[model samples]
Target chain A: MAAAEAAGLIAVGAGLAVGLTGLGAGIAEGNVGAAAVGAITEDASLFGKAMIFMVLPETIVIFGLVISILAIFVM
Target chain B: MFKRSVRKGNYAYTVTRVKAKKSHLLREEDYDKMIQMSVPEISRYISEAGYQKEMADLAGKYEGMELLEHATYQNMANVFNSILGASQGELATMVSAYLEKWDIWNLKVILRGKSYGLTGNGIKEDLVPAGKIDEAALDKLISLESIDDILNEYSRMGKVKFPADVISDYKESGNLGVIEDYLDKLHYQRLLDSISPYTQPTKIFLDYIRRDIDVVNLRTIMKLKSEGIYGEKVMKYYIPGGMQIDSKFAQLLANAETVSAAAGDMSRLDVFEEYIKPVLDFDNYDNKAVVSAIKKYQEDQAKKMAHMYPLSVLPVIDFMVHKETEVRNIRVVARGVNSGLGRETIKGLLVI
Candidate 1:
């Protein structure tokens, strides 16, 4: 009904989207990070590869961040 | 005495460490070098390799082949003990149970020594302190004067009490096979009681154990059938809990006229035997060849399991199996070389 209220509601939606997705990403990265560290410990040469695998799940959070940005600015 | 708690988180760390260790196990190239070298040189090579730290303690007391065997067995036991120490909760429980084979192994050696009237000092060297049964307990079991006393100690340890009749049967018949078979069945029962096949993580482990049981039962049938003993005699050695080959298949294998026929029947039961066909000569049915072939198949199965379930306990179990095989192969090489056997003959005995 009002422009200010609409903007506030949009901000809330963006925050929820990013926050929940970030939490999910953290949960996913926990196991991968543990396994990657284990691999690196065995062979330091795996550091690069393990880092790549460990960070792969962070893409979800990045996607959420992009969606939040669009919702906040464009919507 | 045994406890089970959910420790699924520990598998990642344990499996990773296991993979690292597995990568360091003696490869084909190492065996190539080992087979070419003399016994003393083989000892030097093993010492310079993964057995270095363990060899440090035993190097002074033993030399040549004796030193190598002692160092290899000690390292195997210590590595397994370290693995048990590294694990946690349910993983620890399952690993502990899986490792009870070493306890059973040590106990059987002791019992066999006693039956042969060998002294405690003689038996001590053969005991591997790799399982939950500590060194002191093993020493105590070794020191006991009678079989009844040993069984009492086992009972105190919460193990099943072998019947008086069986002990008398062993005494009268002077056959230690009965006791060893009883111990194996007890170990299987304890394993079944501790972990449920319905649970996650453990299901994979149970599957591995079942496959192992299948291989062991196959080996037993082959050995007995080759020896010309059939019917109930073969059944005496069958350890339950095998999934791939049921009691019926085992019975059929028991009744099979020859080892080759049994191996043929076994190959039809599962893919495990499919790999054994080429190595197994249908007409000859050499028991030693069949034993090695089955061992090879089990190792391959373990490797497949590690690849299939990298994040589970399969990797650790695979590592344990590989390590044991490495130790055994080194022993074979050492013995073969010391006795002036040719390199090709020694290589034939190797699992790698």
Candidate 2:
């Protein structure tokens, strides 16, 4: 492949990786976040625990972001 | 019809709100404290607790059993309505559908009161305002002269089904039992229609409804058997859609001579085997005793379903059940205290 074409392909792959993972994370967080809010509404003590659960799925997107950065810089 | 609308509901927030509300429900210790207090003290305690709004609303108008019962039901309606408001999308629909039972209950209260020559205002006090029907409509229904008038009003309102001829026949026959049975059947049938078991959450919800139907059927069989009446006559009362006891199994259970035998017939089902078996050995099958045992079992199963499906409609349903139980318990305590019944006896009557 031409050098420019290869770089374009890598950019496309990085965007896809981050975009898909971000979508997945949004879906996961939507459910957990709603539940967390509900829990916290009932018992304020649950706020800390709910926060942890609500953010747990966010790691997926973070990892994707890392992959995108590596593709742009390290590649 | 409901299958197409099976979008993800706002579960987590709703469930959390329900849990918070659930935790505030009067505990066993609260009941214990309540049992020992005078009727006034009990009322005061309730007013101080989660029932302040209901108590405040009805303040100075009533007292004792009447006041407590009215407050209890009002609190139930308020809590349920608020939950319905908080829930959005499909959960809101399901919760609203489930709340129709309150409408059915309120209608029955009206019918029963009217049959006894109660005035519209008398019946109005007992109505629970939790369902889709507005207070004005309920008032209009209560004031109507006959069951036919109420039926016409409901029909005019739309989407509510009432078999005019059959109900008229029931009224002519002076058989409120048959009419009530017909209404209950229709309510359950409508509930069944509104729920489609295509999705996992709805499947679980369907199962919960079926299990409730099963318990109701089992109670009917046990009650009939205890009364020494049996055979095909009992089949008329058997409700459809029970997961454990279909019409066939209900028939066999109806045929069983004793409560133990009827329970034995049901022992194959995990639910029956767990809750019913332990309570089957009571020496005399006081209908109340048998009913209480089944009620306890049903409550346990409701709690289990809620825990298992924390994000489904189960938690809200469970909260409703617990709220109903709490209302009943409060009534029992009020009556027990008034009648000078002992604490333990009153405690024995409570399901919590």
Which candidate leads the pack in lDDT? Answer: 2
lDDT of each: 0.81, 0.82
Best by TM-score: 2
In angstroms and one decimal each, the interface RMSD of every candidate reads 1.2, 1.3
Q: What does candidate 1's lDDT look like per residue over B272-310, in tens digits?
A: 445567677766766766677777877877887777766
Rate residue B209 of model 1 by lDDT.
80
| Candidate 2 segments exceeding 4 Å error | A36-62, B1-6, B156-158, B256-274, B277-283
Docking verdict class for candidate 2 = medium
**Candidate 1 clashing pairs, residues 3+ apart or interchain:** none
Candidate 1 residue lDDT tens string, A1-75? 699899999899899888998888987786687677777766899899998888899899889889999998887
Worst 10 residues of 1 chain B by lDDT: B1-10
lDDT minimum window of 10 residues, candidate 2 chain B = B1-10
Tens-digit per-residue lDDT, B1-352, candidate 2: 2343246567877888988898888989899899889988998899887898888888788877778878988888888888988888778878878888888888888889988999888888888988877688888888789877776776675267667776777868987778778778877887877786777868888888888898888788777888877888888899998988888888898887777666656777766666666666547667765577777877887887887766778888899889889888898899999999988888877887
